[model samples]
Target: MVLTPSSAPSRAPSYAAVLRTPHAACPFAAALLGRLSYGVAPLSLLLALKDATGSYSVAGVAMALFGAASVTLSPARAALIDRYGPRRVLPPMAGLYAALLTVIALATWNPGAPALLLGGLTMAAGACTPPLGPVMRALWSSLVPDRELLQRAYSLDGVAEELMYVTAPLLVGIVVTFTEPAAGVLAGAVLVFVGASALVSSPAVSRAHTARPPAGGPAGPRLHGIAALRHAVLVTAAVGLCLGALDLLVVAFTERLHQAAAVSWVLAALSAGSAVGGLAYGAVRWKSSSRVRLPVVAAALGAALLVAGVSPHLYALVAVVAVAGLFVAPALTTAYLIADESVDAARRTQAGAWVNTAFNAGSSGGTAVVGLLVDRLPIALCFGLAAAPALVCAAAVARAGARRPRTAGTGAAGRDAVSGA
Candidate 1:
C-alpha cells in the first residue's frame, strides 16, 4: 500500500512549481508550523527553567539534558515515522511533547519550581518531540519526484528554517520583554500541537501510504548508500562543529574589539548570506552530482572560516562571516539531499535525522572542543583548527572516490547525481 513518487519532470522546475506539487502545500505548511517551535522552544525553556529554579547552573543542566534527549532520540523517532507514517506517529508524539511543555510552563510561571522536577520535565518533553523536519523532507521526496525540483524544495526548506530560527528568537525576545519566558514556552507548545494536528489531518497524509514496508536487506555488499551517507554525516558534523565554535569565537572576537553589540550584526549577516546562497544554489542547474559537490561545499565553508580568522576590521569580519554563511544552508541542504537520495524510502526519515543528529552533535562538540582550545591557542589558530574537520572530510571523500565509485542508492531511489555541490 506504499504510495510511490510521481514521475520525474521532463525539465527542471522552479521553487514555486515544487510547491505546486499536488497536496504538497498542506503538509509542507503544517510541518513548517510545527518546526517553528524548534526555533522557539530551546531558548524559552532555558529562560523559563532559569526563572523557576533561580539558578543559571541548574537551568543549564536542564537544557543540556533536554538537548541530549532530543538529539539522541531523533533517529529513533524518525524511524517510527518511516514505519507507521507521519499521520500515525506524529500526532501522539506531538501531543505528549506539548503537554509536557504545558506542565513546565505552569511550573515556571511564577518561579520556585524544584530543579529536579523542572529538569525531568524538560527532558521528557524533548524525548517526545516529533521528527517534524525529517518527516517533511521525506514527504518532499514523494511530492516532488524530480531531483532538480526536490533540490529546490530542500533549498527553500533550508532558507525557511534559517529564517525561522532568526525570527523565533525575536518573537521570544518580545514576549519576554512584556511578560514572562514561560509564556514563550506556552506559545511553543500551542504551535506544535496545532501544527501537528493540522499536518496529520491533511489530504496529503490521507491520500498516500507515506510509510514504506520496513527497509529490507543490507544496502549492498560494500560501499553504496551507506558509505556515501557516512561521508555526508562526517562532513556535516564537521560543519556543525565550526558553526558551534563560531558563536563563542565571535563573542571573544568582539570582546577584543570592545563592541559586544556587533555579535548580533555579524551573526545576522551570516544568516542572510546562507539564505541568499541557498536560493542561488537551488536556482542553477548543476552539471556535477551531490556526491561530488558535498566535499566541495564543505570545503568552501571551511575555507571561508579559515579566512575569517584573519579579518582585520569589524566590517571585514562581518563580511567574511557572511561569506562563510553563504555555504551554511547550501551545505546543509546538500547534505539533506544526500541523505534523502542515498537511502531507500523506508529509511528516508531516519537517514535525514542522522544527518541532523550529526550536525547538532558536532555543534555541541565544537563548542566543547573550542572552549578548551581558546585558553591554550591563539584565536587565529583556533579558527584553523575548527576548519580542519571539513577540509579533512573533503580530502577523505576525494580519496575514496579515487579508489571506488559507489552506486547511489537501492530500492526505489532512481534519480541520478547532478551538478557540483
Candidate 2:
C-alpha cells in the first residue's frame, strides 16, 4: 500500500481536481484559522474575569480550572472524533463553544453568577478544539504521493505553528487592550465556530470521511500506541515536563525579583529563539532518522537546562532559555512524526490525540511540582529543579539507544521516508 510519485494521477489538475484533493492549501488555511481562535481564548478569559471580579487571584483560579477541565476532557473528545468523523461532530461542538462563550460574557457582567461559567466555556472550547493539525496531516498523507512532498508539507505545518503563536497573541492582545477584553473572547468563539465549520465543510475533509475503511476490517497499523510505550515517547514526555518546570522557574524568579512584568518579555524571547531553531532545523538536510535526531536534541536540551539552573542573573537565564528553545520545534516535530509513522492511517487521529494528551499531562505535572518547590524554597532552587528531571530524561534516552540499536547507514533513508498522518 506504499504510495509513490509514479502512482499519482496523470493530468495537471483543474480547479475541480484541486478542490477534491485531500490535502490542499485551503485546508491548511482553515487549520491555521481554527488554531488561531484557540490561542486567543486564554488571554480573553483572564481579562474578562479580572475586569468583572476585580480579583486577579480569582481570575487566575478560573484560568486554572479551565485548563484542568480541558486536560481532563480532551482525550474523550478526541476519542469521539475517532469513532465518528470530524465533519459530523465539529459543527455541534463549535456551536456548543459559541453558546458557552455567550454564557461567559453574560456571567462577566453579572455579579450573582460565579466565574465558573468562564471555566466551563474554556473546557467546552478545548474539548471541541478542532483536530486541525491531525486532520491536515491525514489529508496530506492521502493526497501527496511522494515522501519528499510529505516532508515539505510537514515543514510547512511547523512554520504554521510558529506563525499561529506569534500572530494570534498579538492580534488578540490588541483587541483586548483596545476594546473590551470580553470582546476578544467573543471574537475567538466566533472564529472557532466559523473556522472549524468551514474546514469540515471543505471538500478535502469530506473526501477523507468518505474514504474510511469498512467498520469490521482489520484496522490500519496502530503505531501511536506502540510508539507511546517506547522509550522515545517517555523521553519526549520528559522533555515537555522540563519545559513546564522552566515556566514555573521563570514565574518564581519574577516573583522573587518583584518584577513579574518581565515574565512576558522573557517568554517572548524564548519563543523567538524557538522560532529561529525551527527554521534552522527545517532548512537543514540531516542524514539521521527521527530516532537519532530526537535523542540528540533532547540531550542538548538537557545540557541547556543544566546551564539555566546554574545561571544566577536574569539575563543569563534568558540567554540559556533561548538557547534551549532553539531546538524546541525540531524536538516536537520529530516526536509527532514518530507517533504518526508508528500508527495505522485510520487510527492516526487517536494516536495524535494521545501524543498531545501525554505532552500536556507531563507539562501539567511539572508545573505542579515546580510550583511547590517555588513555594518552599528560594526562586533559584526552581531553576535548579528543572535540570534534575532533564538529566533523568537524558539518561532514559541514552538507555533506550543502548537497548534498541539503530544502524547508522539506514538512518538518513528512514528519516527521509517519514510518512505522517
* Leading candidate by lDDT: 1
lDDT of 1 by residue, 136-193 (tens): 8877876777777888999998899899999999999999999999999999999999
Cα deviation in Å at residue 282, candidate 2? 2.1
Q: Please list the residue runs of candidate 1 whose C-alpha ends up more than 4 Å from where it truly belongs after superposition.
A: 1-11, 208-214, 217-223, 406-421
* Per-residue lDDT of 147 in model 1: 79
Colliding residue pairs in candidate 1: 286-419, 287-419, 288-418, 288-419, 288-420, 289-418, 293-421
lDDT for residue 238 in candidate 2, whole number 0-100: 76
Task: List the RMSD of every prediction in angstroms.
Answer: 5.2, 5.9
Candidate 2 at residue 183, lDDT? 80
| Top TM-score hit | 1
With a 3 Å backbone cut-off (N, CA, C), the pairs that clash in candidate 2 are: 137-421, 138-421, 221-344, 223-342, 223-343
User: Over the stretch 1-421, how does candidate 2's per-residue lDDT look in tens digits?
Assistant: 1111223344333333333445487777787787787678778877888887778888888777777666666657665666687888777877887777766766775444565655566566555555566666666655664444455555557666776877777987799667777787788778777778777877877777667554324544433336432645676677778888888787777777787888777777778877777766654445455655677777778788778777777788788888988867777766666665655556556656655666667788888888778788765566666666656765766566557544443344343223332
